[model samples]
Target: MTEQRSSPTTSGTTASTGDDGGARTGVAALVLLAACTALAQGLARYSFGPLLLPMREDVIRSYAIGGLLATVHMAGYLVGAVAGVRASARVAPLWLIRTGMAGSVAGLAVLSFSTGSAMVGAGLFLTGMGGALVWLAAPAVAVQVYPCDPGRAIAIIASSMGIGITLGSVVPALVPAVGGWRAVWGIEAVSVLVVLCVSLLLLGSRPQVSARAEESGGWRPDRRWIWTVVAFAAFSFGIGTGMTFFVAALRDGAGWTVRRAGATYSMIGVAMIAGGVIAERLSRSLGRMPVLVAQFVLAAASMFMVATGMGPVVSVAAVIIGTTMSGTAAVVSADLHDRYSPQQMAAAFGLMLIPLGIGQMLGPTAGGWAVDLAGDPFTAFMLCGAVMGAGLLPLVIHGCRRTRRAQTPLITGR
Candidate 1:
């Protein structure tokens, strides 16, 4: 019983009518969806990076507590992903995402009143939970809408996360000049309101599908997607470190202005949009694993370049990292979607993000602590790059396996 917002269809392809009425309606809906997801994720993802210094300075709390707030958020993200994996396929991705957007407002509101570490941790954890739900549903929804081009659609949604991260950081640099941290958060709440309205308009009372039942005949609903989870975690953590803390990293090391650093990062968002376009087109010809490996390698190199400190180098490098980072998630999702069809798309989605959460959690503290330990940020930056490089080993090995398999039939003349 799949009740979905759909066009009348034949077998594999959907039918198009005169004036393309269905196409117009679908485009409008997609635009609304992108706007809402970008707003929802941007609020949760970037708000913390901009607020990190202010929160620590204003509240007299530990940096550990501050960094851990992101971890807590990712922790909640983990929980939400797990839950979404279980429930999202059973329900509408729109419903879960909307609920997550609403939850973000509550988390932001709670942070406004906090005095210490507990507040930081609790606020981030709950906020992460909400963000996790929204993020989990987004890819699933994108897949539903563009079944044949899920990679491209997922890349777009993933790119939106990058947009949110950039907006989150940059908005503060300007707004705080006028209103302080509280002002930034007030704007966050309002932005979220806009998202809610758009979501209702685009996603309103829509029929939903169960991807789980369609993909899996009688496979267990709760099967653990271990490999998929690991891949996402690695990719997520590597990127998270950059988004959550690199602005501060630039400030601490080179005395770069927050605005300058934030603006530099915005390039990453632009690059992500570009990478997504490439990923979609290439997926048809390059196949899955090859494209993914290339993205990961590029992602690692981008981190290394940043840590090493190249003034002009960052501009081009940032574009490369930003663009490829989001694409990494799309690749992982494609891999999972091709191989498995468990009941819990959301949970599976979230579980895959665990490494991202963990990597994100480790990235900042390690970056900061290494600088603290080494007496220079260059050493610290190099170390973080190394950790990121190490994560790529799994992808490299996986790629090798795929290549060997592809060549096997040719070599044996099968």
Candidate 2:
């Protein structure tokens, strides 16, 4: 499940090389890829969570319906990922990344033009598909350029997603003073387009992608890699569940105001930042599995704290959990780099996002149900905690097997 970078073609055919110049060029291109991810993920992908309440109120969707909308958005993302995974040969992944970002930009632009439920849903689908494509393509670039240090390269690229999520939250708070919720999409569209154009100009001299892919073997992840992707999907799903509705749950469960409760979400974002930096360093030192298991465990604990009710202790616990869970993007991306062929990079990562969609679909619904039935958040928090804990089991078991195997002796010398 590994592919080498493209070999240097004969004079002027494709201009491939393993020279320092080529590596540097490819790394520069990856910087653009990371920039693209920062733009798409921040504005198009993650902004959904912050918009949930305002959009739901405006469109008159039930809590369950809100869950469905998120599910549908992720469904489109799943399709995009599968599409990336099915490549016949190495095409220029950058082009696909650009096209995806463009589609999301267009979709966001259109989202501002209507309030009809159907239009809104369609816009979200395009947005999801676009972001999925960017995420799929960008990391492939990261791995190719720094094939010798793929994990470090991928961690740098993956960290952009965390940055994006944090920025996405900031957008919502600005929505009111700026214009309206719809205007937020318009602003992001313009910002993304400008960044894309600027990146193309400054980063134009990079080596052609075809050169890189040929070296990396080709554009196909093995069938075996799908299982790992599914596992990551589970990991992402549980994390999303805890995070997606945390602020809303707090406000509802404890009768806190939006301003008062939003801090918890912000703290989660800060934790994500801290966790991301640490995860990258840790993954490099210790490898992916150990780091990933630790993160899942952190997520489980954070969910318990979040569910327990709002107190300083719970808040700290939420920070610990949120940071740990949300920061999985880097470690998982690196894991994909390790477990699959480079060509299959985007598709594999995209496939893992499925469980994330499922978990998010459940979070609000379950959280709402708990609030209703328990008559206090105490019961609901317990339920949320349980869901997160359930999510952690598969991974911990998987980790245990790997650990035991690592400890087991190899056959004696002949």
Candidate 3:
């Protein structure tokens, strides 16, 4: 792939590294974009996991239905991701970011007043769509601002989602004080809107980060890329199942308080904040495939611990799972950057997300079925671990064969 370098420019004004004022403005714009990512993805989308129990009590009663709601959200995300691939080719990154944030704000507002399952699903769907658009465009904008270190910029953008997750964990604690779940959504809507406005002010003009795939002969998937997608899908399945039901399992099966579960869940977000950086460094020394394989193995072990529901062990497990989840995505994204030109990056990455999204969509509902059948979440969690392990078998075997080939001695004919 040809390397594409972007010179930072906003509203057609060039901002070179030597210009101190312009550099500062670019940095500020990048920071605000990261904030938008946090609100759009972390608060609007993932806050659902922490608030699921209350939602169950208030509107959704069945575990199956609860899981279906998550599936509905993922469906919207899948659609958005696919659409983003095309949209990125035409729209400015800043406009896409702003539009996405607006959608999230609307979704959160709708959720605050929703009293039935249909309304709740609608809100979640909109939130999921908004989150996808922001995530799709944010990294490209970051790369434009920090052209010297695209990897670092992307990692920072990825990590910001963890910050949002960590903050959202505090919502469960304030559930009673502020009213119920509806009030929580209302507060988040207002907060996200405030951030969106600030982001608009900071990002005065569109960053000239063009993603015209037509110039690069668009993205085409190969056999190796398919294997990577499969691996990612499996990882998503395990993570989606584990995260979606984690708090509920602790409360219902393990008999823990909501406060305690929420506290423990916060560890996942805390670890996730450093996950991308850690994975990037490790991949530099160990190679991405080996690092990814180890991550899958560790994730399986952690999910098993989560199944046990022991307090301390589960907390440790949460950290492990969180790190692996974010680390895997970071490693995969870096690999994509290495293989595809900037023009093709958006389309390639967006297409790749489809399988992972499908896996996530299926995970929660399958876990819910397992829970309903077993009359507890233990079997569901165990099944998730098994699914994660099983899904990566092809990739593992391919890696092993490649390693063996490398170690073999070459025979010379004289």
Candidate 4:
């Protein structure tokens, strides 16, 4: 049985009865979703890069242990994705996201007082789990509510990560007076609470969707989708590994001061904002697959530039890498929208993220070891570039096969 949902005011459309009201609601929802994402992912996940060095100097001991904490965080995200997929039937996505935001606040609080690696890791894990729920629900709601222009909606929400990343780094870099990673967590927790309040006010009501199974068939991904999943995993591995260590790369490899490194890292946020907009426009004009392929190549090139450790080159590469990373969602979501039904998208997207989570989990570990081996971040940067470039091979094969199939149909007709 297929489920159907209708809002009393909006019915059959994302907007309400009045044109102005509908526009207001959509704008409000997008803005709120973006803020929520900034809090959930930007602060919760990406903040670690800026905070890690401080924690290491003050309390933590080993780089491997710190990286392992990030790995555990991704593990938590993996679990949360699986849980969200199962629970989506019973729970409203809006409520779930609110709950997740609350969890993030609590996790940050735990981090503020953590005395050991184990506690720190646990806090990060909690934060990641909460972030997964918020991240999943935010885009799902945006796409669900704004079906007419889902790509744009997704782009806006995804761009918030950059906003968050920028803030996460800038705040601490600017406020050395506060001192220590603990203050960063505490301040972020407060900020997240504020966003949560605004999000609750803006998105209090849930879209009415009848919870019904469309098919008895279990979720089974085909071969092409499997490759797509692998591609995403590989791409994410590079992003996860590189971004996780970006500040460290600048400080350790390039002989940059902590403040300078943090300041430079904010450029990523600027790039991300620009990239999301550019990706949306490019995907519409150039096609999603082409954009995806080009992004991977560009990301690889940027990572290679970062490996040079020249201040100017690394700074420029940071923007390019950030742009490429943030644009990933634009192509993936656009392509998936073409392939999957609205109902299936939520579940399918959730499932695909499992591999991404796995890649995220391993990325930090491998990158940290590489850094250790080289006694600098050069090897880690190159590893990210190599992995990102390697992802292109599978995508190219998929594209070639698709082209051949299209030609075969025309040949048969002829």
Candidate 5:
């Protein structure tokens, strides 16, 4: 396949060069952006999961309140996702990236000093907004830096979130040594600040046009794109429920120790780091649509395994879910890039994420209710699998239509 080149007007001076130095700079910029993504998506957002119990002990006493705080964070993410669509139309992607990073830093700093549930909830809300903004805008910047290979660039950014989640999982272990949960937040704040500064230096204030704007011809959402967004929401719903209940299922249903369950859960994060790379390679070899379909099937199968409550099989299921969850999103984004103009990509992607945010907000609560009603976490797991299976219908239909359209010319020519 011929690599698509971004027009100079769209990509700015940095993307116009094919020299070795240009490539090095682009790589460096992408790495820095990936680091920002790690902090925003990984640490700032996920560190809450590990820190929640300790935070409850120190300030918030009720698990219900803690759960409510998480919901507030998701609400903020939904708001940010909506804002990102409008923000992309009025500002540069780099501006969105930097501003989002600043929000994460501020939220983390707030969490470090929070003494009450309200304060912690506020901090989480800020972090959620920041995370969503960064995620929505970073791909646009990635396309600018690596115009010829936006898929790879996006994969790097997506995979880096796994690194953050893995590191966040380790934060609880540091609570005693760090003096408290608050101190862990302090350290994370400093870490995010360091990355933010480096990103500012690496990506200067030069204005670049939207990625592929010249070739996009002002793209708008059609039936296919709308279907893609719905599929994305279903994907989010399935993964959110699965992740929310994964460790609980192992510990409560399979009679595993807390340590053992957490260790098994960490495997998901570790596998996620490799998910994007694996997906990109497979998409290159097998084609994006086929790879995407295979990922969903694997995810559904893995969820079924978890529902079985077989300890060994559940371990394998965790790994499979980790590998395919992020991988599916990467493939979906790359597929969307095939259709959207650079100028529209950020807004379009952000619009798609709104449903994902809603799904995330609803999935865990619904899963918890299902478990309560059925008196078994396994039932909820089965429901997650069913949701994913249902999600596959739209993608299959869209893919079949796409294939038929591609073949029509050959048939008519004959």
Candidate 6:
């Protein structure tokens, strides 16, 4: 059998820099990719989750419609994901990053200027599409630029999602001062545009990968990849609900004001940043699957706490949930990076997103229906918990099987 085990330390580059110099350059590259991630994925895609309630009350005017908007947004994500996979093979990765950033600004501009539902849908769809491209390109570039330490580099970039969400959630606090939510979008657009320009200047041309690395980890229809997809999908379903409706849950379920929920959401963002910072370290120390298992279990527990109406615990749970999810994503991204070369990353990662996109697309709608059926967000929260908890078992079993198989030959003296 081929070596199914993933090693984060392997790389395609031949660098001879001093440790300190390499560390410095890696950090700098990480920051650049993180900024790009924050702008493209965070500001562009995640902002919608926190902004959903306000948009519903002020503009959307219905729960079903709001859910529909989220579904549509994710639909666009699916489309963009497919496009990114194909485009990355033919285009410069930096160009795709630049395009994603520019598209986000354009989408936000549309959302800022329009009040119609069609416009909202169109804008959000565009944002989703752009976010997909950003998500695809940023890490691809990061791993390439800092191939010496792909896990840590990818973790730094992935952490930007939390930062972006935190920043977006805070916008409601400025609603009164900025005149309206639309103004917030306008400001974010300007800020992201600036980030986009910076990314273009900093990202430079795409680095060429050695053809050997490109063709090394050929796709194996193994149980491991299948479990990864299943785990990722389940996690996506659980987190997508919280991400899209956590504020609504707080407002409707916990009876907190939207402002209060938004503040709490910011806390989750902080946790996400912390998670990003710690993900690679923890994965390196403890192994990727263990870290992922711990995070997923913790996320389920956190959601359960929220479901039980433990108010004080909700914020704490939010922190753990955010940390685990982001950490899990970081570890998984790094694992994929180890599995595929820069030339093949876009397609591999994009293919992985198929299940994730489907799960995300279904989450909001499913959560909404659960709320409607149970007449409370509590049931939806519980559903999230159950799905996540169930998802962890398969991963644990499969990972153990892989580990045992990897060790069997040595134990048998083969």
Instruction: Report the candidate with higher TM-score, 5 versus 6.
Output: 6
Model 3 global lDDT (CA atoms, 0 to 1)? 0.80
Ordering by lDDT: 3, 5, 4, 6, 1, 2
lDDT of candidates 1 onward, in order:
0.64, 0.63, 0.80, 0.77, 0.77, 0.76
Tens-place lDDT per residue, model 1, 1-414, is: 121222212112232334467556555555566666676666565677767766657763544455556667777777766676666546656778888888787777667666676776776777777787787777766655554445566667776766676677576575558566756766777777777877787667443453343432434333224433444455566566666666666777778887787788777766665666567567547766677767776776777788756678777778877777667666666555555442333345555655566666666566556565766655545665566667667656765776788799899995
Off by over 4 Å in 4: 1-18, 206-208, 215-220, 408-414
Candidate 5 is scored at a TM of 0.88
Model 2, residue 287: distance off in Å is: 3.5
lDDT of 5 by residue, 10-67 (tens): 5344464478887787788888888999889887987776676567578866434554
After TM-score superposition, the amount by which residue 377's alpha carbon in candidate 6 deviates from its true location, in angstroms, is 2.2
* Candidate 1 worst ten-residue window by lDDT: 1-10
TM for every model, in the order presented, reads 0.84, 0.80, 0.92, 0.92, 0.88, 0.89
The global Cα lDDT (0 to 1) of model 1 is 0.64
* Model 3 lDDT, residue 252, Cα: 92
How do the residues 316-338 of candidate 6 rate in per-residue lDDT, one tens digit apiece? 88898779767887987766655
lDDT of 6: 0.76
Which tens-of-lDDT digit does each residue in 1-414 have in candidate 3? 243443334224344556777678667777888799888987788888899998888999988888888888888778778777777767767777888898899989989999999999999888888888898888767777766667777777777787888888888877899999999999999999999888877676645665443623656886557877887788788888887888889999999999999998888888878887788678767787888888888888888999898998998998997787667767776667766666566566777778888988898889988899889977778988898888888889888887777667543322
The model with the greatest lDDT is 3
TM-score of 1: 0.84
Q: Which residue pairs come into collision in candidate 6?
A: none
By TM-score: ranked, best first: 3, 4, 6, 5, 1, 2
- Model 2 gets an lDDT of 0.63
